[model samples]
Target: MLHQPAAPVGKDPAQQYKMRLGVWMVIAYSLFYGGFVAINLLKPLLMEKTVLAGLNLATVYGFALIIVALLQALVYDAMCRAQEHKLSDQKIAGEVR
Candidate 1:
């Protein structure tokens, strides 16, 4: 009879962090999308004529999205740095073994 190797037990911290990050990304995306939809739905009612610089609703939305994307990128970068630090600490302490 051939015996297969058993699956490894216990969760790795790095893997756990990755999973958490994925969940957070999903949540963030959902919220972003939902907010976008809500704003679009209420745009006509909320939109106001701007005399300053002559910016329209569409332009405002575009700028808002660009800002959101930049902020999200920064947030993701910080999260990645935190995860890297955690992994490095674990490596130094020999927790990965």
Candidate 2:
């Protein structure tokens, strides 16, 4: 009789991490793109009043997008750190077993 190899027990942490990161990336990109498009679409109405001289709608929108990107980076970093901590704890527990 041929002996069969045992099936893998649990999910691979690295793969799980990659999968999660991919999902978050997709979500972030979608939100960013959607917001950019929406801003462009509403630019005429939004910048009707001239709060500052020499400031065009495109310039203001560009600055806002930069700010949004920075915030997204911070959020993503925090999420990655949390995921790392959780994975480390899981690894320690597995090792103890």
Candidate 3:
């Protein structure tokens, strides 16, 4: 017995859009993350200052990094889905016409 995929898979129409979006998001995230590293290196004592709710800069920035990554992931997912939907609709429209 052989197993088969539920849906036929082929080339992705949104490949280019996905790649471009992914790369830009990565660069944006890297820059944001780099700021944290820069502060730690250049101004190590600055991390001890309380920023919010008595949380030190290190604690706050650490948590912010996690939250930002999750938010970025959500944004990336939504954008990719929108692009895929747009391309899929165009393909369907072309097929109908």
Candidate 4:
């Protein structure tokens, strides 16, 4: 006999959406990091090129990555807050019915 996969184990729709959003953010960050690694490994000299008065390409790229990470965190926080609000509203609505 074949076994069926268990249901989401009390996971509600909002919870699932939040999980998916988190995974997507992780994937985005990973890909951004991978690009930097690839560039460094493929052409170390490329990173040494001056982007600013003294800053090199590598330094600029690294800083950009940090900014992106912070932005992602902010977005994630907002999304989670919205999801929590929505889920709470749903619960309250259900209770009233």
Q: Which candidate wins on TM-score?
A: 3
Give candidate 3 regions above 4 Å deviation.
1-8
With a 3 Å backbone cut-off (N, CA, C), the pairs that clash in candidate 2 are none
Q: Considering TM-score, which of the candidate structures 1 and 3 is the better prediction for this target? A: 3
Tell me the tens digit of each residue's lDDT in model 1 across 17-43: 767886887688778667767867876
Prediction RMSDs, each to the true structure: 6.2, 7.3, 3.1, 5.2
Report model 4's TM-score to 2 decimal places.
0.78
Error of 3 at 75 (Å): 0.4
Worst 10 residues of 3 by lDDT: 1-10
- Indicate the residue-level lDDT of 39 in model 2: 65
Q: Give the Å error, residue 52, model 1.
A: 7.5
lDDT of each: 0.71, 0.71, 0.95, 0.91
Clashing pairs in 4: none
Segments of candidate 4 deviating more than 4 angstroms: 1-13, 52-54
Q: What is the TM-score of each candidate against the true structure?
A: 0.58, 0.54, 0.90, 0.78
Kindly indicate the candidate among 2 and 4 with the higher lDDT. 4
> Which 10 consecutive residues of model 4 have the lowest summed lDDT?
1-10
For model 1, state the Cα shift of residue 36 in Å. 2.5
